[model samples]
Target: MIMKYAILSQTKDLMPTLGLGTWQAPPDVIENVVYNALELGYRHIDTAFNYNNEQAIGNAIKKWLNDGKGTRKDIFITTKLPHVGNRASDVKKFLELQLKMLQLDYVDLYLIHVSFGFHCDPEKFTPLVKPTGEYELDMETDHIATWKKMEECQKEGLIHNLGLSNFNEIQIAKIIKEATIKPQVLQVELHAYFQQLKLRKFCEENDIIVTAYAPLGSPGAKDHFVNKYNYSPDTFPDLLGHPEVKAIADHHGKTTAQILLHFLVKQKITVIPKSTSENRLKENMDIYDFELTPEEMNSMKKLDKGEKGRIFNFLFWKGVENHPEYPFKLSDDKD
Candidate 1:
């Protein structure tokens, strides 16, 4: 029997629970990754304007659509609004560029990539940095206004639904309370180690679909962050080496990554595991074949460290943590 899986958003859209993430996917390799993922039954493809691989993704999608593999409607495409384009007026402009790059007239979901805004050079779309070597932020950032613009895009058929990423529960609540069109989804870092139980429960009660970006604990996230942004490697934990996760994997005869993903899917959360390796890509989608016992679920739940387990705190952005809307505050339970 074919196992079916999906997460229904507030708009009643059926998003495939498993998706291929395109973050940090090199341009030279992304096209093939996209093609292979589509051929291997990945109907959900996640990309972002900042990923700089939309053109490559567009190429792959064009080829697949031309080959009659699937129609545009069969694929659920999600992209984000970059920090520079986080303003109310720049919303349509940035999405139009992404739509053009992705070779699509409309996207299935468009998200506000970050809560804070950046001062960018519109000509090159590069963010301006202050003399202190920090990103130049727009102190007048207004997410409510930005979200209203997103609603306009939806009404104009530029996008099917709206959502937010890297936003906190309070931020989401603010948007919901002030929004004419409620956010349909919320994308954030999620794994067994940092299950985000409180936020997940909030979204569940609010009818918002939650998507996990680093579902496998982002095994190499530490190295990547340290090398790229001068962050301390100690900020990230090794999820694959966790004793509880290893035991669970051994019991199920699966890799630790698969067990991590399976645990989240069991909670009805959508996940996007990014990998350029063909084997890993296939393995990421191979979780539906088995079910974790209730005891195994409880064991996974024990791994949660609440706010302390968060990896992408965005604190490396210098004064970004000081922003009023900064999401990853509180080094403990209050967050």
Candidate 2:
């Protein structure tokens, strides 16, 4: 089984191009999903503190290791710092908690999940909400300070690779300018519809490996927003069901999901598409066997709708658009 990889500039670590994304995955079933993914040859697993499923994922990894399936060094585990813990003071605290929950001495990659901050209760570690039902915004959110603390943790050998998620180029530049160590990866919402060409180019020049979250256009996200916040977008992207994508899939004798993933993987853009179904998991990994033609890749590139194609604006968090560190532009202006 051949697999593509992105080399981290700092340590030259080979991060597998395809990984298992675990956002919106319920904790109850996450253990089995993770265990099944490991059995199916997945080496990279992406999770976050806010996902609240790290403990279960830890159980799966622990069980797999105990069964003598693989050692910790063989697997790459990536988790993040939650928005509530976005402050420099909270970096080590939350990281230690995540390590404790994941039952690991260190994580392969630790990312600052978001650029913004949310005020939360210290004891519960839950984001505090205003009486108006909006998130309590932390106006003084400081990226450079938080990033400095992240570098300290990396120096202490707690995090092997340090990265950012949902951070724009400007925010990343600020960190790079202040840091002793540069960020090795940038995980963002990337798909065929919302291809971040300019951002990817910037990362390439900076030697930051870009990881794509919601790589399948996050088909389940609409329902999640509606159920959790009673908010729904005017339109939801269905990249897997698009006629153009289907045609490409049929041409290659592959599923639409496979074509979507292969299109990104072929470009050396890491993709973490989430799935619980065993068949889909295997299907997603089988993409390495086939290659999309140059013409097909061009056609796929035409699907880039830019900012309008973006699905995760984080608007469901009520007043999040007003945050000082909000990465996306809320109006007609391009980010």
The lDDT leader among the candidates is 2
Please give, for residues 205-306, the per-residue lDDT of candidate 2 as tens digits.
999999999999998888988788676555788899989999999998999999999999988899999998899999999889888888999999999988
After superposing candidate 2, which stretches have Cα over 4 Å from the reference? 1-3, 333-335
Q: How many clashes does the backbone of model 1 have? A: 0
lDDT of every model, 2 decimals? 0.87, 0.92
lDDT tens readout by residue for model 1, 1-335: 22345555556777888899988898799999999999999999999998999999999999999999989988999999998888898988899999999999999989999888788986889788788978887888899989999999999999998999999888999999999889888999998778888899999998898999888888767778899889877778899888888888998899988998888888888899999999999988889888888898898888887778888887667677666667777557633
User: Candidate 2 versus the native: TM-score?
Assistant: 0.97
* Alpha-carbon RMSD to native, per candidate: 1.7, 1.4
